[model samples]
Target: MPLRSVIKTQNNQRRSFGRDRSGATAVEFAMVAAPLFMLIFAIVETFVISAAGILLDTAVDDVAREVFTGQIQQADIKEAVFREKICGKVDFLLTCDKLKLDLRTIPAFADIPTDVPMKLKRVDDSSFCFDPGAANAITVLRAYYEWPWTASFLHKLAADTDGNSVMFSIAAFMNEPFGDRLNSNANCS
Candidate 1:
């Protein structure tokens, strides 16, 4: 109970506490957990986005055939019908309402526009131009969707920052000689 003995005991207790390894597991976990969880979430998000991209590409490939073969034009398939077909072919997770499509047919392949549009820059759907030109013309089809996300970082990484990532698919091909598309008043507009 001397002052010197009390000081020595306090120093020894402090040193012991500093060297103690009892909480090492929690400390190590804390150091590793943040990065580990981030990596896991990133991987999951990457997988999902990749899957969506594949699905979109597959749907475009399937639907583009109808356009190339003039089936869509011959049937006079309305714009809504074409959209409905595309939606039916896509995954259930994709909201059909969010799908935006742009289909353009040019006189020749050389005349094809070189822009890769992903989202609707303008809000007016009526303002869009759709020209599924005559038979043997080159047609380009583009579709866009905003996939919702719960992960903040992934959303910020996306071109759109509202916790939504823009997913798009494109297809270009020459219309087969099924019939003269110019003669048919395809209601693609």
Candidate 2:
């Protein structure tokens, strides 16, 4: 073959190889980067949600402790006790009126009523009599918190997919911290 023809064939081969390699970097990038991005985003979202849940749980336990110890009175039900103790302590996580605290004294596990009121009342004042044998009676404090999602995208996802409200309930139980001691004659209705 002539030298000119040989050189032209070599140049043609090089041009074909260059065209084939053109998109190789982009394919490699797509393969590696897609899953890595997803994994990173998932981890960040999980951490945010878990932190919010822990904060809400802590707030519930705090409020329940106060209710069981008789530190909160009927007058202080929603406004004073809940506002100051629970909602105030949680940083922008919960609101006072948005929370519902229900304290029930269960004389017997069977006596625990299903229709529990959504208020904090003195268990002693209720017509429900306390049984001494049931001193191990259960005091159920239910804390309902409406947790707003920190991420707008997550909020929309929850609403659209699960139809679950942004609210969650955390219940803390302690044996009636006070068996039968009625501290104040003040009506805890």
Q: Estimated TM-score per prediction?
A: 0.74, 0.51
Judged by whole-model lDDT over C-alpha atoms, candidate 1 comes out at 0.74
Instruction: Write one digit per residue (lDDT tens) for candidate 1, span 9-122.
Output: 999999998888799878999999998998899899788878887888889898899888877877776677778888998757577888888787766677755544433532
lDDT of 2 at 94: 48
lDDT of 2 by residue, 49-116 (tens): 56766887787777666655555532234434454666676657445665555555555566644453
RMSD of each: 8.9, 10.0
Where's the lowest-lDDT run of ten residues in candidate 2? 122-131
Off by over 4 Å in 1: 1-21, 117-127, 159-163, 181-189
Best candidate, TM-score: 1
Counting clashing residue pairs in each candidate, in order, gives 0, 0
Model 1 steric clash total: 0
lDDT for position 16 in model 2: 90
